[model samples]
Target: MLKTLQTIVVAGALLFAGQCFAVDMTGKVVEVLDGDTLTFESNDGRLFRVRLKEVDAPEPGQTFGRQATQFVETLLKGKSVRVKISSVDRYDRAIAVLILPDGRVLNRELVSHGLAWHYRVHFPVDPALRALEYQAWKQNAGLWVDPSVVPPWEFRREKGARKPPPADPSAMDYNGIFDYGLIGNPDTKLFLWPDCQGYPEDSRGFAVFGSELHAQKSGFKQSPGCSRPES
Candidate 1:
């Protein structure tokens, strides 16, 4: 009787271990919500909202936000993807590393293209991924075009208390009209603005300009959006 009970206990422990170590999940991408959010349907018909681990993209109205979303849409929308969940985030989103049918890693691709920032919240130090982000920044790829690219997390903080830029006609470029709705003041520590448009007026969105130096001069703030510009 005692031996029988011991055998049962061992079997139960093995079963629990198997569940805990399950790493692979197959799903079809149903939606590409943004640079980092995706919806997928599993084989068992379970729907999951996945947040890419070790990356953060811009919000829709933020600077370069639309471009980031479009980039993700081009990459994964309506495709079959395999997810490897590492953990769950504070917001209860499944944090995962995604691979497409072709075995292309979505997390690495985002960092390489500068579409997403390397998120280290639950991730251990990964030098390879960090190096990819640096390489993308150096090449001025994707969102790296804007020197004042602010991370989405920081953008949320500066959405308030942002004062309007000095109304100097010289400061305003006649040929280069800025979309104030998405402007960011890169000079200040907390680049705050009222809305999600351009700097001062909208501080929560990504900067849309291609030139990072131009973005800085145009009053876009830097907040962990990507690596600093080359010296």
Candidate 2:
């Protein structure tokens, strides 16, 4: 029994180590470029432009854009943070999750405070962040106070519609059938209706289920966004 327990403990330790990410470095935030982007300087005098992963705050043209920047600037500028570098984005920004001085994850905090969005394009939606965002919406916090609030993603999309050509019939070959169900946020272990407010973006991916039975057999539970039976 003792040998078996030791083996189990060693296996667990290895599993945990495999799951842990190596933080590239720690730094002092020197600039707040926007709600989701910033500049930081490491102790060794290296500077890096870092983007807060999984949080997409508004652009300056959108409503509450200034407020979002201000919120991030107030909390992050001149603060000590640890950077868990994930990957470098196309723009050459270091994709990272910042652990702030308060021991809170900055990405989650911005979404929690209604100052930013839970971006699904780069990462899966965290359920706690989803719930916090929902609560902020329910309480009419910040951007949520705007009843006609268009999400940043939607707002950006609409910006392109200001002057647009009519859809070509040839390019409009999309089928009229709507036979798709979603298994959203592999991290949150939840599924969402495609139209749900917190639906994961296509970049993060949604496994389309042609039938509900497929969704069930694949171990995805229906989220509240859908009217499917919760069983």
lDDT of 2: 0.65
RMSD of 2: 14.0
Model 1 per-residue lDDT at 181:
26
Candidate 2 lDDT over 51-129, as tens digits, reads: 8887788888877889888987888766778888766655556678888887899888888878887665522456677
lDDT of residue 137 for candidate 2 = 66
What is the model-wide C-alpha lDDT for candidate 1? 0.61
lDDT of model 1 at position 58? 74
The sequence of per-residue lDDT tens digits that candidate 1 reaches over residues 1-231 is 465335434433443445533456897877778888876666756555678877878777587678778877888767777888765544545667899888889888888887777764332446677788778877878876765455676566566223344464234232222112223443443332223223243333444542344566666655454333221
Q: Kindly give the number of clashing pairs for every candidate.
A: 22, 0
Minimum summed lDDT over a 10-residue window in model 1 is located at: 173-182
